[model samples]
Target chain A: MKVIVNGEPRELPDGASVADAVASVTTAGSGVAAAVNDEVVRRSAWEATPLRDADRLEVLTAVQGG
Target chain B: MERSASGVEHEPQEDMDSLVIAGEEVGSRLIMGTGGAPSMQVLREALTASGTELTTVAMRRVDPSARGSVLDVLNECGIRVLPNTAGCFTAGEAVLTAKLAREALGTNWVKLEVIADEHTLLPDPIELVDAAEQLVDDGFVVLPYTNDDPVLARRLEQIGCAAVMPLGSPIGSGLGIRNPHNIELIVERAGVPVILDAGVGTASDAALAMELGCDAVLLATAVTRARHPARMAAAMRHAVEGGRLARLAGRIPKRRYAQASSPFDGIATSQ
Candidate 1:
């Protein structure tokens, strides 16, 4: 299945979770947030939460900005 | 008598005028924004030199190829991160970004910035107000970045915002405070802290913001973009303290006619 992570399409195995999508990017333990289709999925729920095809997953972290 | 670093004697005012926002006391009044720094190493030095306890960081998509995180530098410096919604344009977008930041940073404090356009990077008053109200309702400590409008500041305050941050000018413009009168007006009426948010080009500008009665000044470009970021940061630290001290020690009123220091009665007869 294909899932969108941070505006880029990536192919992931079936039954992939939000955690899997985030792992595909960076391995930051904390200071990372994931949202599926615009609704925030908390870190504790990332592993429990699952994603579907074409799901827009946004993984955000703090950067140097104001 | 306690003395500040500048050698000015200060009466021991209780707490030494700590900046308290939403029940949290930040030691320094110089609130920094982590932007425009040449490198992470430079940023670390500048932040430490500024002596800012609280700093702003923006939330964006995680870059897989990126190196060290800004959060790590902040963590190492022991500065509290105040997440900001920098590029959002609408109330909804700002609200979502605030929530994301809260979740990411594990803090409910947000620097609510709803920009109207990219050219000016000015806050859209309507969107900013709406987002502030929503974030306040969501139990987030909202510090809104708004135009230099007293009415808007009042409105944001009435809606339970933690502080009202009005721009000295546009963001990163290096123009300094364009309308000191409006800033003074906002300061006069504000119940919460009035942080002069942007357009601080140098130390004097930061000092003037404090002298104008602003509770604090939030700036980044002025320091981060300087040839020597750490030096400018130190200058800003002094400027804020100097300005605050000057405010405390009220300035004499301006007069049309010059007054002689020596009295005429004391003057000796001259032949």
Candidate 2:
């Protein structure tokens, strides 16, 4: 499956869920949140949330920020 | 909802003790985040409310053909960029990221953050020091994101960091000042400005940090993710200003009873 994250396209495993997609890209124990098609997907729903072929997934994390 | 000066209503401005880094004077002490907003419109509005002069943003994994929108929104708002080394764990990686950010953003200023413990989002002090030294040598105005360690802060300042940002609490914990005494130590001893960055949850947290003599506060989740992002932003702006004013005013020594600002004892007794 293909997903767009922060405007960059990446290929994910077939039938990959949002949770799976997030885990694939992020480091272990990193604090991250996601928005799919511009709607925020709470952490609880990441597993159940399905992705489309060209879904825009915005993944953000709590890094050292201002 | 309303502000006053000398017992009279007045328009509000975020604290007067602005931070001067690289000769840039920022009006608001509360630096905000650009993430977690329900919409970009709300995010922009919240930034306006917070009266923030410095805002955080990240670099994108480029596809060359695709256009990123976050940067444009930030530029449109006219807030100064404090591009962070968000994902870099090693000193070399951080330096490279800082270089990339400078080239991409057209600013020599970089927020140097080297994360060691991914779970807690705690900084790697050893790596941060190394990165700061290298970046400063490279002519980047390094603002190191670090733990609340006075000795470490002094070390960074010695290495030419523009400012030392010590965490009030863990990033995004919404926990205000887990070790304020330590933060106070950093503030009192450091020659450069100390900005209380990360884990600030509310306006009072920002205020308390200022009252503790911190030069500024940088937070994102508290306002960007709030139930009322814009209102929280506004509150933080005022809170920073109030805290700064109170700090400048200075306080009377602690006493058994409240000391009156008015000359009650002299006036009534004399009359």
Candidate 3:
């Protein structure tokens, strides 16, 4: 299924978890965090977290400022 | 030891109480950051423009491949460091990051950021309050980056935060005070210093923050990411000063009818 990650759509393998989806797309770097469909997935749960159809995933980093 | 803008000996102002945080008096109210600038030179120039004595920096693993050296730049500037736990979620995580920052920076001052939502990057008040209490108990001067909730502000203040930082809007959005009324409420109620942190797009936004009684402003993107970072930084510094002066000067009350600054009745009785 196609899942939106950071405003871009990427093809997700069947039964892809949040962790799997995140690793598939962006370069793993410092200060990264994620929200799945407006609900924040705690860092620990990112691995077990599963993606639903049309789930809007937003990945952010501590770029600068407050 | 106080130094004037021209590097002359200067005495600290008696009437203006230096911002007392963890028993240390910080001279400048403006707190800058060391991220998002195109280059280190630009970052240094922007910091100079802002006239900020305290600069916020994050603790990241030293990448051997990385080009910019935040330490060398910041050390040269001679500014006090304010480290942040920017991406921490839970109290435990934030506390850990704070400890690491203290160890790395050798300062007890921490900008505790417990983000609940990743999309908006808003602070989780529940987790934040919990972290603040723990950090304060652990003897770390906690400066929580939080939302513009007055009750939450009071709660955080009661929990012993050095300062309360309410967002003008989402981080890096540059929306410029989406909720000024709530910010004013936070300002009116907060016992600790209220710093309008994040989402300031322009100099006017910083000025507006000061006019609303905020003690300071913590911004990075508005300056670092601007087309002319140094110029924007200088503008923001002036805006902050002008707004502070205006607030001290006491603004005229708003009225339905125009009340002219010069007397409308008769000033030299124009023919």
Q: Name the candidate that leads on TM-score.
A: 1
In the range B27-82, model 2's lDDT, one tens digit per residue, is: 66777778677677888898877778888876544333332355656778888777
lDDT by residue (tens digit), candidate 3, B1-271: 5777898554355348456665677787678877688888998999988988898877543333456466567778887778888878898778766775664456789999999878989989889989999999999899999988888988998988888999999888999999999998998887789989999999999999989989888899999999999999999989988777676657888899976667566546556
Ranking by lDDT: 1, 3, 2
lDDT of prediction 3 = 0.80
Worst 10-residue stretch by lDDT in candidate 2 chain A?
A24-33
Per DockQ, the best of the predicted structures is 1
Off by over 4 Å in 2: A1-66, B1-17, B63-68, B256-271
DockQ of 2: 0.08
CA-RMSD of model 3: 10.0
Query: Each predicted complex: what DockQ?
Result: 0.92, 0.08, 0.08
lDDT of 1 by residue, B44-161 (tens): 9999999999999999999888999899999999999999999999999899899999999999999999999999999999999999999999999999999999999999999999
Looking at model 3, the pairs that clash are none
Model 2 CAPRI rating: incorrect
Q: Chain A TM-scores, one per candidate?
A: 0.97, 0.81, 0.84
Better of 1 and 3 by lDDT: 1
Task: Provide interface RMSD per model, one decimal.
Answer: 0.6, 12.5, 8.5
* Models, CA RMSD each: 2.1, 11.0, 10.0
What are the per-residue Cα lDDT tens digits for candidate 1 across A1-66? 999998999999999999989999989999999899999999999999999999999999999998
